[model samples]
Target: MDLGVKGKTALITGGSKGIGLQTAIVLAEEGANVVVVARGEDALRGAAEKIKKETGADALAVAGDVTSDEDVRRVVNEAIARFGRLDIVVNNAGTSAAAPFGVVELSAWEQDLDLKLFGAIRFSRAALPYLKENGGAIVNVTASFAKTPGAASLPTSVSRAAGMALTKAMSRDLAKYGIRVNTVCIGLIRSDQIEKSWKQTAPEQSWEQFSRDPKHDIPLGRIGETVEAARVIAFLVSDAASYVTGTSVNIDGGKAPAL
Candidate 1:
């Protein structure tokens, strides 16, 4: 499938590693020019280099904090300056900040909201004008916990739930401009953080053995790969999914409880 995104420009937050990096590579493979954003300049540049090397696609690295409005605007502007047009925005920057409600301080809650919910808000708002001009797509990366919150899933759950709402509302409001907004609710996917947990919790076991352990309860038998989620995100942003908007797709390998 062509995906109909060749030559289009995509800006992805959290593109330094894991799912975000994989998504950038996938988009670039499909012939889309990509702008990779993250706080670490070195990581962002490395990701961009990897994308270009793997896909032979144009890739730009922009280092900035997503939680800052000024940084968000600068990222968008730099992308436009480099690519001359923006066709896709993937709000994929976030961390897994969860703790018991009682233990999670007000500061922690504020920081979580700032990084997850408001970060998306800032980038989306900053990219709106460019997206409007081209009739583009925006894919918000959330979590399955947004739909099925578990015990101890604090600010992350709340913030992700708000992200889903933002997707739906943005879809409705942006439809008239030919801009589509959707979200991917991720489950257990291979990532740097997941890798750290694997190393700490089961250092003796191989990654395959550890991930397939019954304790995780992933119905598909193991944790998902970054490419799995990346493919779905790529589809959502491509012309192949032109009619998909105001919807949430769970990329959890059947682990999420909700429909």
Candidate 2:
């Protein structure tokens, strides 16, 4: 399918690994110039190099923390400066607290929201004008946990739920300007973050236990792959999805039940 976005430019936060990296690769493969942003310089550079090598897409790596306003401004400014215009913004950078919600300190909860919720808020504000001007797209990368809201996921779930709200709000406000706003609620997917999570939760679990069949907590039985999630993200940012806006498309394998 021709996404019809070959010469456009996209800014993908948390683009160093996992779904962000996959999104970068997919967007570049479809002919979009991508600016990859994350905290680790090495990982950001590595992701850029790999995307360029594999997809032959023009990719730039910007290392910065999403929670910091200065860092966010720097990354966004640099992308606009280099690309001269931006067509897509994917709010994918986020992190959770070290401990689960109830057991953690107040600071932990605050930090979690700072990264996932407020981070998206700040980035959206920073990119809004450009999006209005360019008639671009915004894809907020949320999680199904926002819907399930488990006990062990207090901080993360709270912030992610807010992210979903922001998506709907943006869709309404940005519609007149042709800046479509949508979100992808991710279920369990194969990524470095998930591997780290499993290791922390159950170190003894083997690779077999984490297979990609629809056998996991998801009703479909297995977890999703990063690429699987990436495809949905690409679709949302593509011309093929011109009419899709202000919607939270679930990428989970039937794990979430909201209709």
Candidate 3:
């Protein structure tokens, strides 16, 4: 199906790997120019090269920290310089920093909020001008835990909750300008970190076996792939979902209890 994103430009934060990189590939395959942002220069460049080689999309790698306002501004300016316009912004840069409230330090909470919450705010604010020009879309990547918090989940859950709130507020404010804002609350998606855990915890088991161990409690009986989450994000940013905003979609294989 055509997503109607041809010739459009997209900017993805934390696009060097995992869901971010996969999302870039999906958008590029659909004929959109992509700018991937991350702190690691080498990884970002490699991701850009992979997108170009695999999808033949114009991909730019921008190395910068999302927590830094200057870096966020530079990333947006650089994207506009490279693509001349921006149609999609994916605030995907974040880490899973969770722990019990008693064990979590003030520094940890501050850092988590800085990266996940303020990071999205910084990027979205920086890209607002260009997005306003042509009516674009913003997809903020949060986690399912944001909706249904469990024991021992602290900074991540709180920060992601803020992200969801940010999405709703942005959607309401940006709708008049024709700019759509939405979010995807993901769960148990496969990534390098998960792969490492799988190997370390159960090296004797096959990946298929490990992912379906039932210990993870995924209702689908397996971990989700990056492309799975990526496709949902791609659809959200595409013209096909023009009417979707001020909402959050759970890409959690039905694992999130709150829906």
Provide the clashing-pair count of each candidate structure: 0, 7, 0
Task: State the lDDT of candidate 3 residue by residue for 14-68, as single tens digits.
Answer: 9999999999999999999899999999998899889988998769999999999
Q: Evaluate residue 168 in candidate 2 and report its C-alpha lDDT on the 0 to 100 scale.
A: 95
TM-score of each: 0.98, 0.92, 0.98
Model 3 has an lDDT value of 0.94
Q: How does model 1 fare in lDDT?
A: 0.93
What tens-digit string does per-residue lDDT give for candidate 1 at 27-126? 9998898999999988987898888889888689999999988999898999999989999999999999888899999999999999998999999999
Clashing pairs in 2: 213-222, 214-220, 214-221, 214-222, 215-221, 215-222, 216-221
The order by descending TM-score is 3, 1, 2
- Poorest 10 consecutive residues of model 2 by lDDT? 207-216
Which stretches of candidate 2 lie above 4 Å from their native place? 98-101, 197-209, 212-215
What's the lDDT of the predicted structure labeled candidate 2?
Answer: 0.86
Task: Quote the lDDT for 130 in model 2.
Answer: 86
Clashing pairs in 1: none
lDDT of each: 0.93, 0.86, 0.94
What ranges in model 1 sit over 4 Å off?
A: none
Error of 1 at 29 (Å): 0.6
